[model samples]
Target: MHKQIIFNLPVKDLEKSKAFFTAVGFTFSQKFSNDQAAFMHIVGDDIRAMLMTETFFNSLINKPVVNAKEGNEVIICLSCESRAEVDSLIAKATAAGARIPHPPEDHGFMYDQGFEDLDGHLWNLVWAETGV
Candidate 1:
């Protein structure tokens, strides 16, 4: 069985992507990063995101890369410890130049908000009451 999941995403600018994520509080594994790609740490070693330069990413796939801004690629949702944490991250992301596609939603048992990264990748920050 697989012990980890790494989501690969293509970006227009690797350095800008790294800075944006850094402001949102995501750390990278320097050991896995280089000029054309970065290993973004999401959940320790269990989950991760690979931000790759579009040219480098295209070389790995046969299909043309989707332009995230013009279309929906995938929404990466991450669980947060609390609703406050979700809001905090959203605030950070927005301050770092991300755009909010919609307002935050709260359902008593769950709360969620999302942002569009520089590369237009959609990411949702969610918090759920434990044991739900």
Candidate 2:
């Protein structure tokens, strides 16, 4: 069975992407990070993201990269402990130059909100009852 997962994404500016995610309350692993790429730690060491420069990312994939700002590629959804946490992350991301793509949603047992990062990646923050 697989024990770890990492999502590789292309970024125009590594430093800016790092800063945006940092402001959104995420930490990075310096051990796997350098000039061309940043190791963004999402859920400890088990699940993470590699924010790479356009040149570097292009070399890893054979097809052309999608412009996230212009079209939909993938939506990264994260589970939050509570609705407050979801809202807080959205607010922080907005303050860090992220664009709020949609309004918050409430469905009795679940709450959701989302923001677009500096590189136009759509990240959804969701809070749901654990027992449900």
Candidate 3:
């Protein structure tokens, strides 16, 4: 069996988060979704992020939820096939309600852009130049 990674994130509204992710080109597995959370399938068997309601998350853990907006505890980085793919995802994410946290950065060998999801989770979309 192939190993997969699922990052669980707390959201204020499950439906809204679902809509946002869908608009940004992510498909969710309804089989894993319920009233409290939606499992978003990203990058086919490689990456996924679970959108869970605060109440549901609280029920699972005793620690307080980190306020992603106030401070980022983690930055999810996704590698892309090309620079255009990185740019396309950033534009799509922005149109889908994500806020661009920084201008696209070009590092000669790699290109990257940053955005904050509706719940303030940080995501870095990147592509590396093959010839570099």
> For this target, which candidate reaches the highest lDDT against the unseen true structure?
1
Reference-based TM-score, model 3 = 0.94
Q: Write the per-residue lDDT of candidate 2 for residues 1-132, one digit (tens) a residue.
A: 998889999999999999999998899989999999999988777889999999999998899988889997799999999999998999899999999988999998999999999888999999999888
Per-residue CA lDDT of model 3 for 4-113, tens digit only, reads: 99989999989988998898889999899999999899999678998999999888899998888899889999989989999888889999999998899998799999
Deviation of model 2 at 109, angstroms: 0.4
Candidate 2, residue 65: how far the Cα is off, in Å: 1.2
lDDT of 1 by residue, 14-115 (tens): 999999999999999999999999999988889999999999999999999999999985799999999999999999999999999999999999999999
Please count the clashing residue pairs in each candidate, in the order shown: 0, 0, 0
The better-scoring model by TM-score among 1 and 2 is 1
Deviation in Å, model 3, residue 13 alpha carbon: 0.6
Candidates in order have lDDT scores of 0.95, 0.92, 0.90
Please report the candidate that would top TM-score against the real structure.
1
Q: How accurate is candidate 3 locally (lDDT)?
A: 0.90
TM-score of each: 0.97, 0.97, 0.94
Sort order, TM-score high to low: 1, 2, 3
Off by over 4 Å in 3: 130-132
Candidate 2 pairs with clashing backbones: none
Ranking of all candidate structures by their lDDT, best first? 1, 2, 3
Model 2 CA lDDT for position 132: 82
